[model samples]
Target: MARYIDAEKLKCSIDSETDSIFDWDMTIEELYYNLCKLIDDEPTADVQPVKRGTWENTNTPNQLRCSNCEIIHFIAQYPHGEINYCPNCGARMDGVLSE
Candidate 1:
């Protein structure tokens, strides 16, 4: 997630810090930048685009095949809406998939 500075809270905090007896090792702006850098260093995961496919019914009543992988999957029911991904290839079917 991206971080943003809250101007009102920062102003209030700076006002209170002005009354503190602690000696300044760095300028207030420099200290603020350092604190923000620490928060911005948090890890974020990247989502990669994957091959998309829909399930196609097979000869077996409860089995469906993946359009992308052509691997058959067995489920409790046929034409089920709950099956969202191809287990073998991880092709997504829950959202709008590109060719």
Candidate 2:
């Protein structure tokens, strides 16, 4: 699978093989969920795993993106919010099995 790291400042840490970028308050699960959402909107529907990454902000951002599909999903999952994605196809989880 082709992989690419897109975040500018964050990439530096990865290249250096350091954990500096991981010390932020964000959880791995949250990052994973966000990654799925960002890549969910790709036009190709490739259903392949793609690489997308982001840096931590002092203030938690409003949205997180899927790594593969590039679809925007809400950071806060609330009463009327749903942010889910398919591991196989990177499809947006619209409160359904295959949304």
Candidate 3:
């Protein structure tokens, strides 16, 4: 299993004691890039995208209902079966996916 840290947590974990280290602030993208480099040093686990669809298909419906925190992940092969989860609040999609 991969361990995913929030952006804020990642920023605080950086070491600033090196001689060449500077205090120049970095944007979220830059921080994320550096964080990825650090995380890449170890055997990284899979970090699922914050969007819908699988790794192969990037064109799937991924909208979620904020009131319930439910998401339509992917339609299952079976008639009514589908893979869904609430990535935002981390809840299960118990309701049927809408078209």
- Top model number, TM-score: 1
Candidate order (TM-score) = 1, 3, 2
Better of 1 and 2 by lDDT: 1
Best by lDDT: 1
> For candidate 2, lDDT tens digit of each residue in 12-96?
4344533433446779986666545444422332345533333122233675554445445555654444345533345544432
Considering lDDT, which of the candidate structures 1 and 3 is the better prediction for this target? Answer: 1
Each prediction's total of clashing residue pairs, residues at least 3 apart in sequence or on different chains, is: 0, 12, 0
- Candidate that beats the other on TM-score, 1 or 2, i.e. the better one: 1
Report the C-alpha lDDT of model 1 over 1-99, residue by residue, as the tens digit: 544555555555555655452347778777777556544543343445577888777777767788889898888743555678787899886544222
| lDDT score, candidate 3 | 0.45
TM-score of each: 0.42, 0.22, 0.23
lDDT agreement with native, every candidate: 0.65, 0.45, 0.45
Candidate 3: where is the Cα deviation over 4 Å? 1-13, 16-23, 43-99
Distance from true location, Cα of 90 in model 1, Å: 0.7
Clashes of 1: 0
